[model samples]
Structure formats: structure tokens, C-alpha cells
Target: MKETEHSNSSILKEIAELLNEETEIVAMLKGALVKFLNGTNFETGWIFFIDAKGRSELVVHENLPEALAHKDCHYLKKGGCWCVSRYRNEELKKASNIIECQRIESAIAADVGDHAGITHHATVPLQSGQERFGVLNVASKDTVRFSEDELALLESVAFQMGSAIKRILLTKQEQEMALVKERNRLARDLHDSVNQLLFSVTLTARAGIEMTEEDTVKEMFKEIQHLTQDALTEMRALIWQLRPKGLENGLLEAIKVYAEMLGLQLHVTVSGVLQFPSRIEETLFRIAQEALNNVRRHAGVAEAALYITVTATDILLVIRDEGRGFVMDKNTKLLSIGLQSIKDRAKAVGGTADWVSEIGKGTELLIRLPY
Candidate 1:
């Protein structure tokens, strides 16, 4: 009576806190998982999220058995368990109570650990309306059946989780859309203003060079003209990258065109299919552009090669040049700006960048992005 009412109040308070949370989805999920455990007698729990590809990934978990934790149990890596399979098959549309856990059963059968202690659990679908997000599973050490009220409470929490997940996803989409609009606006402004001004400056410098009779004056005009031309090329490249043409065809095609425009010999090799999130593809394209810019301005090499490997779990990009390489050190400040930008871009996509360079040995830039 009083205890149940107190528990319900705690659950409601947690739900209110969850509704007010503005953190990232993963962090919010972790908080909600903790709240769920606090509201129930379950000693352990986990959440799985279904991605765009319909693949179930173990996104969060709490308080697993020592043996399972030691084994580094990854449900996605193991191709999911019975609850996930049933969820995918649409068999567990509502709160499933006192069901056998095949994962724990298998672990016990193989003498994996004291997993026999966890014989069964209650699984519920985290969904809102017709949209399904994933599943939430909770289990206890002692064999205890959940009551009807407890199951209803779990369903309510799952609903809130689903709503939060949906809101976060919508927020991300809005942010991405906003970013694209801003990029387009900046691209247009650069093309109409700075790009036109640079073109005029190039023309004026060339005319001045032709009209000047003094050799020194002519040389200065020539230098001005060269600088203007270089600036114009760089500006055009920036505009093109800001709103890349033929990106829909794919990143490889776009890179091929860019390399052609730069008049650099490009050798491209691709292994496996190249498909990735839009942000990741965009980041890789920008990094490749930066690498090519380095090759053009400093490499002193006529050719470069780009190797790309795409897998279900990760994407690898490698750009190599047999050009005049320079010593890299934080104190020296040589090409640090561009390299740092590459690193930042890789990090933005949850990836990493490595630069291998030595004087007279050329340079190789490697990037790995995991999805």
C-alpha cells in the first residue's frame, strides 16, 4: 500500500526528470535505465536500439553478471539473443513476463558462469504509436514473477523512452538540415562576392603587367597576378566543396572530378561497397580535398593515390603521396593547421586520423571511421 505508492511516486519523479533532460540520446538512455532499475526489483538490465539498417545493437546495459562482463558479452556481436530475435519478429509487442532468457540459459549450459542464477526476465518493447525503437529487458537474481501493476509501470517507462528517443532523432535531423542551409548560404555569398572580386583582381594584374615598361614594375605585376590566380583557385575549390556537385552520385566520383580539376594524376582503388552516413561521407570528402590541396601546394609530386575500404562496421580512407615531405613537429608549425583540421573532422565523425611523414620519404594520411 504505502510502499507501492512511494515507489510509484519515485517512478513518476524519474519520468519527469527524463522528460526534462536535454542531453544526448545515449546519456539520456543511461539515465532512464538507472531510473527504471530504481523503480523495480530487477538487478540487471539492457537496451537494444534498432538502427536504420534494421540491425539490433546493444546500446546500453547495467549490472551484468561477473562472468558475462568478463566475457565481454556484446549482443550485436553475437547476432542478438532470444528476446531481440522475438522483438524483431514482432512476437513481443507488449510486456512479456517471466520469459526464459536463452542467453543466460546458454551460458549456464556451457558452464560459463553463475548465469544460472538469472533464469528469466521481463521484456518490453520500447515504442510510441506505430514506430518501434527497440527493446528493454530486466532481470533479477532470484526467481520472481512481476505483478500486473509492475508490468504496467514498465510499459509506461518504455513509452517515455520511446518518446525521448524520437525527439532526439528529430532534433538531430533538424540540426543537420540547419547546417546544410547555412553552408549553402555561405557558398553563395563567397561565389558572388569574394570570387568575383578575385577574378577582377587577376584580370587587372595581368593588364598591368602587359602595360608596364620597367622590368621591376612588370615583375611586381606578374607576382600580383600569380597570387590572385592562386587565391581564385582556392576560393573556387572552397565553394565547390561547400556545395559539392555530383555528391549524390557518390564520393568517389566527386573526388575523381576534383582531382581532374587540380590536374593531379589520381589513382583510386576501392574495396567493398562504399556506403556510409551522410555526415561521414561529407567529412571524408573534405579530408580528401584538404589532402589534395596539400599535394598541389607543397608535395611537389605529380601523382597521388586514394584507397578506400568500406565494411559493415567501419570505413577506412588512405591517401598517399610520393612528394617532398617535411619534418612534422608541434614546435615547427609545419602544415599543422591543415593536419589539425583533418584530425578534427575525423573526430567529428567518431573516427581518427594518422599522419605518417618524413623528409624525402613522402606522406601517407590514414583515416578510420566507425559506424
Candidate 2:
């Protein structure tokens, strides 16, 4: 009797430990409840969450035979599930007699092969402070299987679950707010840089237009068209940069968009065969954007090519320009900001940037980094 009592205490302690270890509220509760059911020889268990849209969706369901799970999905969406009305009305403290009050007696008891055996149900609402997260459900073959002690244990588990979920939700909300703030900051920078540059270009073209010659008028019109197109491209680029969501389309897609925008605006035939590390795709995308922006500004050449190659261990980017080469001098802001930005970005991710140029020849920026 002493050995049996000690073993039972150990099992209870293990269950408590398991419950305490989960960081996510729903996951931990579902795991503990499922383990409790499976360990104590119960038939099935489930966890459901009340979504923002007030829909009672299944979060986790375990040991429920395939047929029952399938049926539950249908019922979870429809009003067929026992907890539907309870969840909809926010009645957490209601009596756990969902199945006992079932109107569909024959439908509930119908045998769906091996899965039809489980009939008894006990549901406990997962409450955290004043808010209710969802419900914990357990089913058994034997009627009246849940003792008062078991009910208390289930409620305790739900309480723990609610606390964890509350913390996670708060953290996620804070993170989203921070992301919105950062996007706003980037938008301000883009407006200041691109808009200011276009304004200057507009003033230069207007001055050229006032010159009294037919050839001068044609040249000024071309300049105005080029500057206007560059401004539009810059606006598109900034919009994409500030989107702040969904990397599923990945870095290569962003790069292609950036390159296409540059090709449409600039006199250069900007083209690239870009491929890079799965892990460093974002970094590579930023690097390419910065490099191209520099090409559009300082590289007065009408022709440039961007080539990206991925190898066994590293990704390489080469942006070459047949433009008026830049002088690497302390007075040169373009060389400093543009090259330094690429260099620092590459270095931040354990990469290197090599800039090769002469006064009248051309310029080539080569970046190599581990994937």
C-alpha cells in the first residue's frame, strides 16, 4: 500500500512538472491534459480556442480516433459540438454536463468503427484572470469516470494554461507595435532622401529648359523624363521596403523587383542572375538595394550589370558600372555613405565588401558572405 501511494504521488508530481514547463498556454495545457488522460487510461482529450472572430476552433486534439476527429472538425465549425453554445455565450462556469444534455442521442452514440466507443465527456473552461481562453475536453468509455478530484486537477491545468496564453498574447502585441514604429521611421528616411534628390533634379532640368536653343529644349525634356522616372522607381522601392510583413515570397523576389524598378528608370541596362543563402537572403536583398541606389546616384554611366552567384558555402554579389568612376576621398559623401553602408551590412553578418574603381575607368562592388 505504501509503494502504491508513493508511485501515485510521483505520477502527480510529474504531471505538475510537465504542466509548469510549457511556455505556450494552449500547447502546455493540451499536452498535460492529453498525458493525464492517456496515463490514467482515459480514452480521449481535446483543447479548443476561442479566436478573435468569436469562433470556437480546435487548438489541439489527442487520442481521439480519426473518425471522431473528423466529426469534431465539422461540429466545431457548426453548432453540432456540445461546447458551441457555451463558448458563444461566454459561460465558463456552467455545469460540465454537455453530453448529458445532448438532444442528438442516437447520433452521439452511433458507432464510427473503432472510434465510436468514447461517449462520456467532461469540459473545463480555461480561464486566465477575468478572461477565458478556451476549453479543455476529456472523453471516456466509462460513464461518470471523472471524480471531483479529477475535475479540480483539470481546472488547475486550465488556470495555468490561461496565464501562459495571456503573457504570449501581450508579448506578440508589443512586438507588432514596435514593427509599425520602425516602418514609419524608414518611410521618413526614404521621403527625405529620394524626394529631396528628385526636387534638386527638377530644379536642374527647369534651368536647362529655359536655355534658348531647340537642342537644349530636347536635352532638358530627356533629363526631366529621366528624373521623373527615377523618383517613381524610388517611391516603389520605399513602399516595398516599408511593407513590414510576409517574407514567404523571399529575398530573391524582392531583389528582382528592385532590379526591375532600376532598369525602368535609369539609362543603365541593369540585369542580374541573383542566387543566395536561404539564411542570408534578407541581408543580400538589402545589400543589393543599397548598391543599386549608389549606382543610380554616383555612377553617371548609362550601363551597369548586377551579377549574383551562390556557391557551396558563400554567396557573391557583383554590381559593375561603366560610369564616371568615383574618387575615394574624405570629401566624397557618396562613396563614404554608399560603400560604408554595404561594408557595415556585410560585416554585421560575417561578410566582406570589395569596391574597385578609378577616376575615369569604372566601378565594381563585390560582396561575398557565408550563407
TM-scores of the candidates are 0.84, 0.54
Model 2 stretches with alpha carbons more than 4 Å out = 1-30, 38-41, 52-54, 75-77, 94-110, 212-217, 220-230, 233-371
- Single out the weakest 10-residue window by summed lDDT for candidate 2: 264-273
Report the Cα RMSD per candidate.
3.5, 16.1
* Candidate 1 per-residue C-alpha lDDT over 1-371 given as tens digits, one digit per residue, 9 for 90 to 100: 89987887788677758766755878888888887787677778888886555577677888887545546763223634766777778787788785566566665566655663677778899887788888898878776577787778778788888888888888889998998899899999999999999999999998998898999999999899899988988888888878887689999998988887777889999999887788788898899998998899889987999999988888999999998987766776555678889999999867999988888889999999887
How displaced is residue 344 in candidate 2, in Å?
32
Tens-place lDDT per residue, model 2, 90-157, is 76573264555242233344544354555567787877677777787777775555776556656655
* Model 1 ranges with Cα > 4 A deviation: 1-6, 54-56, 71-80, 105-116, 326-335, 347-352
In Å, residue 128's CA in model 2 sits off its true spot by 1.3
